[model samples]
Target: MITRRRSHLRAWALLGALLGATGTAWPAEAHQARAQAPALCTSSREPALAARMSQDIAAALKDRDGTVSVAVHDPGRGLRCRLGDTRLYDSASIAKVLILQAVLGRAEELGRAPTRLEAQRMKAMITRSDNTAATDLWQKLSRARLNRVLREAGAQDTVLGHDRYWGLTRTTARDQLALLAAVSRRTQALDLMGQVVSSQAWGVTAGAPRTVKVHLKNGWLPRATHEWRVHSIGIARGTGTTGTAAVDYRLALLSHDNPTMRYGVRTLEGVALAVHRGLAGGTAARGFTPGHRISETPDGSVPSGAPGPLPPAPPHPPQEWGTFPGTVPPSRTARDRRRAPRRPRSRPSE
Candidate 1:
């Protein structure tokens, strides 16, 4: 009887040890699984607002292909929304913004304002999207100087293009947000960016209310590898309504692998429209209306008239500035073809 009792106690002890071991192993396994899980999309705001924004943005991108990244900061509401914010995309003409920033910042460093010629080039580069002006300024500023400007702006993930190809620079939506935020805070840069030629202000501006002042830069390039890369970054401000002070927000949208430039534009505008409505508490009826046509000429020199015969060739062939992909809808004419400068035979990368 004693031996039998001892055996039973030993069996019970073994069972308890086995159960304890299983319990410990299960938590460790569960922890490992948790660690490997991917992060869900998120918004930093009141639960209701966050959910609505997240849902709306997701809906905007539901049928889209390729990759799109967005980052928005609305200090008035103490809110932020991010989706693939760190992903990199080709800068395209959008790099012109950094170029402008570099020129302004470098001017401050040199203890002098930009030269008259530099100011003209800056205006052409930002407002008009002039590639020749951009190239000239890029050479003058040099990569080292521009890199310094980027560093000072706290845009760590942005890289200047190699071989003087400013359009090919790699940058992230988050980094762009940092730069746009700086432009909003700095008076000098804001003045120049705010003057972005009315023709080029379409993407993010399409969603802004008329009362809100907008400063923006947009870029588009169709490359063999990615199909199309279209991006827009901007700052919007207006009077506040919901207990918040003045409304101030910055947004960065980047996309690639689009089937066409028009498609890309539509995608961006849709997302922008949703974001503006969600943040500004505006209804769809008050949303922005995109212009009927889009412009590819960086100089904003498209002639205002009907298409005419090709213009006599100039002394030097008109260098292609920032040319949007063939897929872009022909909207505005900066210059008449009969008098228009001849762009290069090869399509510009931008």
Candidate 2:
């Protein structure tokens, strides 16, 4: 997996060193996994886990049409898996995540908190995928402000929707990871995302253990050429198995040319389930032991009442961001494939 840049590479190296000190055999194992694994993906610390994830993800794509681009980040374990990482797809309502950030961030810039009505609209925008709410917020949110949010988040491949159509923005898996990383830091923003109506919370969080607190946003749209586009960006956290520290992971899955919305959803769900199993453990958490820290529980997991405060997680290694070979370019027929022809906008999501 490519780290986003040199800095991320250095950060990941630092984490590997820390893991070495902590009796975690992840660094060397991760290196070996990379050497042995296909270019599609890799995992650290556990070759079996990485191989299983790669197989499961590929199986999910088998006999399916359209493209599915995946990027998975596990900072605690120093793991990353990517397939078609930089492939561009329609943002659909996924851009609302950036809109949400712009709204809250603009409020902060204005030297005030988001007002009650703004907060309500923002919550509805994220939790219910409400289009009217998004439109209202978009009217008040300027492109410049949105650019500020994207720049702050390191969303390099994302282009703001043309003529103020946030849903139509073009983006890639790597860039969405950047947006999620920024959103993960703000308590109120993440809280709204976590409150997504159960009906709307259907993508990357699937099969995640109840112990994991999942905050995610999913979007889908149908068009003439690609048929349908479905995408999801998410952050999951739970108690790390090795210590009191928490497990921090972010995943982005993007797809287009699905025959139907449900098919696209299925493609993402299979990959997501495998991811949760691979990272957090399925049936039982594979690496878990009794009596771990409860003091700093971030995901609201049940506390073990162990004495010490939460240990710090391994330093988040920068993601591999070097140029990768498997990227699929945006389709070129409509508007240079930067975007599809504008039509009467449908509701932003399924």
**Top candidate when judged by lDDT against the true structure:** 2
Model 1 per-residue lDDT tens digits across residues 259-302: 67767777788789878877765433334334356543322212
Residue 113 of model 1 has an lDDT of: 93
83-167: candidate 2 lDDT, tens digit per residue = 7678788787888888888888888889999999999899988988877788789879778888878888988878766654667
Where in model 1 is the C-alpha error above 4 Å? 1-45, 241-244, 283-292, 295-350
Q: For each candidate, how many residue pairs have backbone atoms clashing (under 3 Å)?
A: 10, 10
TM-score attained by model 1: 0.69
Determine the backbone clash count of candidate 2: 10
Q: Using TM-score as the measure, which candidate wins?
A: 1
What are the RMSDs of all candidates, in order?
22.8, 20.4
Per-residue lDDT value at 196 in model 1: 84
